[model samples]
Target: MPEFIPLISRQTIQNRVREIGKQISRDYQGKDLILTGILKGAFMFMADLTRQIDMDHDIDFIGASSYEGTHSTGQIVFTKQPDLEYRNRDILLVEDIVDTGNTLTKIMEFIQLLNPNSVAVCTLIDKHERRKKAIPVKYACFSLEKGFIVGYGLDYDEKYRNKPEIYDLKL
Candidate 1:
């Protein structure tokens, strides 16, 4: 086990999420918006964010996994699917973080097959430098350095997911 220091505090994360929610609410006002939460990791952020999105929108969840322990598994497993028709609808994909871009790439590709009118991504944090694939993020709260982060839904070996603050591993 390694010691870790808090990176984004709980209050800071809440404030940032409010800001992001305001932006999304403004952008999709009066439009049919479908929120797709990338499950497990994004669950906390998605729940809080949706409460601030003042719009008539539907919510769905998808569970995808590309990591095990502290490493990328290099494969994506979609354990759950979003049960909604995406055709001609604006879709927002909510994610906890975008790291390496492999998982996001596969997710975007899979969503595109549904023929949505538009598809955009919103992430709580982004590791821009670690992106291996060219995946564009439409909305992001912050760009983080390359580090092992946990908390606010991110986890290490399935621990720390419930931590209110975000912390970086000392190693």
Candidate 2:
């Protein structure tokens, strides 16, 4: 079994998420905003953030993968696409983490093809230490210099996502 060390507590995460949601609500108040979460890592964050956002918005999900275990494969493969009609609407991609920017970059390319008015990114964790591409993350709940984390929708080889708080996974 892998040892899990406490990283960010659940209460701390919730407070930051609420703050981000409030900011997003203010920035997108008079526009048609769509929160498109990058699944399955983003599901938990998206759900909580949505409730904190006090404005009318739509929710959608896009599925892609770039990791085999703790390391990124440097390739993005789509598993599902958002079915909502979002042409000309403002889109905010809710991501669990921004690491190498490989998968998110590929996802942005695909999203741009849909012809939205504008696009931005929000993430629960901003891990820029290993970034290969410079992807603009507009709203980040937290930033980590380095560490392999799992919890609050982050996973390790498809495990540890169910934990309510973030953890540093030690094998």
Give the top-scoring candidate (TM-score): 2
* Prediction 1 global C-alpha lDDT: 0.90
* Predicted candidate 2 versus true structure: per-residue lDDT over 1-171, tens digit per residue: 789999999999999999999999999999999999998999999999999999999999999998999899887889999989879999999999999999999999999999999999999999978999999999999999999999999999889999999999999
Q: Output the TM-score of candidate 2.
A: 0.98
Each model's lDDT comes to 0.90, 0.95
Q: In model 2, which range of ten residues has the least summed lDDT?
A: 68-77
Note each model's CA RMSD in angstroms: 1.0, 0.7
TM-scores, one per candidate: 0.96, 0.98
Query: Where is model 2 more than 4 Å wrong at Cα?
Result: none
